[model samples]
Target: MKQITKAVIPAAGLGTRFLPAIKACPKEMLPIVDKPTIQYIIEDSGIKDILIISGHNKRSIEDHFDRNPELELNLEEHGKADLLEQVKAIADINIHYIRQKEPKGLGHAILCAKSFVGDEPFAVLLGDDVVYNDENPCLKQLIDVYNTYGGSVLGCQTVPQEKVSSYGIVASEATAAERIFKVNDMVEKPAVDEAPSRLAVLGRYVITPEIFSILERTEPGRGGEIQLTDALKVLAKQQNMYAYDFIGRRYDVGDKQGYLEATVEYALRREDLKDNFLEYLKKVVK
Candidate 1:
């Protein structure tokens, strides 16, 4: 199989959870400290060609990545070489966008990328997920499994059993590697009492092209919208889908609490701030 060189990021949601704060802003553009969540995802995506599915109020995403010679000139004239280079770097990233036009669902957003994807296997990265891993990027891990198994691979993590209902759960037999599993079944947001296991699907995936056909037939499920989970369920039945328990800390930026945790944890990880931030946090807790 060819290396998956393309990625699709769905950022078209209305972000009602954040309400007025995100009223005119794209949630994907929300900053984690100095960087936007989407930038973090793409920075490590290992993909050169990226297609972002955007919806209402998503113009900022385009502007952020677009080259601004005026701003660059300003930063350069001010002797801010570091800042000037940073803006230039953002401009160099190969990312394109398509309008979703409506807040349908993840499945719908992905479908809009069919033309961009063509017949190649591509990655689906939700902007809400921010995973930190240097040695083995989360998406690279999934792609490794895809190359080995010749099937779709979903990024998964062990969530609390009680939180199983909040995510898609997987049932599988353990492989030689403890974290790799040969997935037998998957249920989207199954009730705790009905969940197959505590293994919850995270927002990263390297999917085969066949998924487009399955998604086309998948009906509106949970929110009266086409769901990626529903299509994956059918794909699971027809093909070999594996869930690799990826090694990384995943933050759900779509939730207020998760977003704050990502911000603090990420900021704490920076070398210059760790000591000071640690002292500040200690004082706040006290």
Candidate 2:
């Protein structure tokens, strides 16, 4: 089994969900209070030397991670050492970028990292969803499963059966490990009535190198894009793939409601804001 050393972040989506604001600024660069959403993705990635698949207006993702010496010097002059460190932290990460050329799909964006990933098993973190778990990052937990299974592991969690239509779901059988299950099949965004189970894939994947070839042959699927779900389906049939009901509070930061909820929750968790923010919330809700 190969060690998972690299990560592929499929950040090429047009982010039409947050349009206008996203028209000028890339959605991945949208901040969750203090840090951009992509920064949270990187912090939870647990793997350095990332290859970010970008497209169209996503240059901000690259610029955000590059050194801003002028900004640094200005902060230094003002003696804002703590703020300066936060700015420098991203610049120091080993990040590489590539444009997807077209807004293909999640699978296509990942395929764009073929040369960078080479033959190693790599983790994929979608920019839309941010899983917060300081004790065990979602992607890192998936890596542990890959190390044990030597195939692929889909980071999943049970969603309401009615909501299964929004995500790719698994046909699975439970394994001895509490929340883990062996994936027998994958169904991409099926109708609620047609869904096999509620084990919805949560977009954190530790995929084997074999998937690059599988994705190459996959035609554009749901929404005329080369869906990652299709490629993973093939991999499951060929070898064992597991779906881990990972530990975390997942925030779908791409959606307005989810983003607002995540912001409030994340803010509540902050030491500086907990007391004041909680009091403010109590007053507002009354």
Best by TM-score: 2
What are the clash counts of all predictions, listed in order? 0, 0
User: Against the true structure, what is every candidate's RMSD?
Assistant: 1.2, 1.1
* TM-score (C-alpha) between model 2 and the true structure: 0.97
lDDT of 2 by residue, 35-85 (tens): 889999998787778999888878888889999999999999999999999
lDDT of 1 by residue, 170-236 (tens): 9888988768998888888998899999999899999988889887887888889899988887888
Runs in model 2 deviating more than 4 A are none
What C-alpha lDDT values do all the predictions have? 0.90, 0.90
Residue 81 in candidate 1, Cα distance off native in Å: 0.8
Stretches off by above 4 angstroms in model 1 are: none
**C-alpha-based local distance difference test score of model 1:** 0.90
Score residue 69 of candidate 1 by CA lDDT: 89
